[model samples]
Target: MAYQLPALPYDYTALEPAISKTTLEFHHDKHHASYVSKYNAAVEGTDFDKMAIEDVIKSIAGDPSKSGLFNNAAQAWNHSFYWNSMKPGGGGMPTGALASKLNADFGSYDKFVEAFKAAGGGQFGSGWAWLVVDGGTLKVTKTGNAENPLHLGQTPLLTMDVWEHAYYLDYQNKRPDYIAEFLGKLVNWDFAAANFAAA
Candidate 1:
């Protein structure tokens, strides 16, 4: 089946104050929807037409001839994952097994936050910062443009979109403030835990 835009788990205004409703509306409805549309168009009549979004991304990634398809398909998948990475009242550290793993892998929750923020903030251009399971070990990584951990044989446990469209309207040019809100008040730890458990 063709790739499609995934619905947000919460209402657009649900993340307000930290993230404005206007930002969600434009980001989800406009930005994400556009990626899905372009991705579908790119795969039309091709072998990727019926492939899963993740499969399509992996298949196209690094193939110069399919760069456009890779960009759109990866963006479509990334945005869907990004939506689930947050919730209205989420964030402020994880717990249980996931919490233990974070401490084991990154020293402590505060250290994880510092590393995550640094990864997100250090992304020089449109990109993402991710916490992923690479070869059964938790690692923090960053990818430029539409790149994601999946393409590198890693399992993404959590991600933060550093693209200007993700925070420009809400935090203006202060990407660090936006990153702080996402980590301090918006991250969906349950979702991360779920991803972690599955990984």
Candidate 2:
């Protein structure tokens, strides 16, 4: 099946001041849309065209000749996950089992914040940071150039897009600042919890 852009939970301006409407529109409609289109184009008239984007990423990742397809497909999946990693009333303390697990794993909520921030900030150049369920354990990881937890066998519970397109409008060259704002202001803990439950 062909890929589609997922709807934002709020208006473009919903993330305002912290993340601008202009940024959302361009990031979602332009940047993400472009990735989907490019991936579709790259796979057109091929046997892989009918495969799910996830499946395509898996195959492309292992095949050197399909690197371009992998980039677009992974970017498509990563951006979609990134968009849902937020909500209208988001970013506060996590709740319930998710919070409990976070504490057990990271020592405290503050520590989770510290580690998450470090993962995002430490992500070199264009990439993403993820909270992933790997081997029945929660861990933090960063991927370069559209790579995500899906590249491996892990399940992603939360993600932050560290690509310049994600923060350029609001944060400019300050990628670390943008990441700090996203964690402090826009992250959706409930969304993370839901993903955790699913895992």
Candidate 3:
């Protein structure tokens, strides 16, 4: 199937103070829509045309010859994941098995926040910070430009888009503030929990 742009789970104004409707308009309607269209155009009638996006991503991730396809396909997938990674009133420590896992893996919820924020803050440029299951362990990792856990054989549970377009309009150059808002008031722990359970 040709990749399609997924609609935001909530209204454009739902994210409000943290992520403005204007940002969502440009980011989702323009940027994300471009990736989907690009990926479809790039993959048309190719060997990858019928492959699921995840399969295409894994197959082409590190191949230099497929970099263009990889970038579009991966960005399309990543943006979809990014939207679901947050909810209208989501954030704070998770509960149940996922909560215990975070505490176990990162020592405490505070430590997980530290490490997660560090991963996002430390990413040098346009990229993503991820919470993923790697070898049965929960880890925080970052990838530069259209890259994600799928490229590294990990199961992604949650993600934050640290790309400038993700936060620039609202926070200007203060990415740390964006990351803080994401962790404090926008993260969807239930989504993470579901992913963790399946992982």
Candidate 4:
């Protein structure tokens, strides 16, 4: 099956005045769409054509010849997760089970935020910050380029795209500010809870 862009749960400007509508349009419509399109093209006529995007990414591993496929497929999955990761009036703190897990894993929500922000901000280039379920514990990690938690046998519960295309139009070169705003005011814990439940 072909991967497609997932619709934003809220309006493009819903994330403003943190993330701009212009950035959302380009990031969702152009960047994410390009990944889906490229993934489809790469898989066409191959045995991997019928594989799920996640499976395709795993199948490709890190082989350079398959890098394009891996990048696009992982990106296709990543962007879909990223879209649902935020919503109107989202952010603050986790509650219920997610809260318990966060505390157990990172000791406190504040610590989690710091680690996530540091990972997102410290990424050398285009990348992502991820909260993943690993070996029955929640952990935070960063992935370069189109890499994702799937490669590490972990389930991504939430992610923040740190790629320049994700924040450039809105935050310019201040990627740290972008990460701060996302964690403080735009993280969709409700969506993340659902992902946790599913995972």
- Model 4 alpha-carbon drift over 4 Å, by segment: none
CA shift of 161, model 3, Å: 0.4
RMSD of each: 0.7, 1.3, 0.6, 1.1
Candidate 2, residues 1-199: lDDT per residue as tens digits?
6788787778998988889999999999999999999988888888888988888887778677887888889998888888889776677688899888888888998988888889888887888888888988778888888777776999899899988988898998988788777887888888788889998
Q: Write the per-residue lDDT of candidate 1 for residues 10-70, one digit (tens) a residue.
A: 9989998899999999999999999999988877898889788888888778999988888
Per-residue lDDT of 62-160 in model 4, one digit per residue for the tens? Answer: 799887778888888999999888877778899999999999889999999888988998899889999999988899999998899897899998899
After TM-score superposition, the amount by which residue 74's alpha carbon in candidate 3 deviates from its true location, in angstroms, is 0.4
Q: Measured by C-alpha RMSD in angstroms, how accurate is candidate 3?
A: 0.6
TM-score of each model, paired residue for residue: 0.98, 0.95, 0.99, 0.96
- Model 1: pairs clashing at backbone N, Cα or C within 3 Å: none
- Among the numbered candidates, top TM-score falls to 3
Cα displacement (angstroms), candidate 1, residue 147, comes to: 0.5
Worst 10 contiguous positions by lDDT, candidate 3: 144-153
Worst 10 residues of 1 by lDDT: 51-60
**How does model 2 score by TM-score?**
0.95
| Alpha carbon lDDT of each predicted model | 0.91, 0.86, 0.95, 0.87
Per-residue lDDT for 63-111 in model 3, tens only? 9999999999999999999999999998888999999988999999999
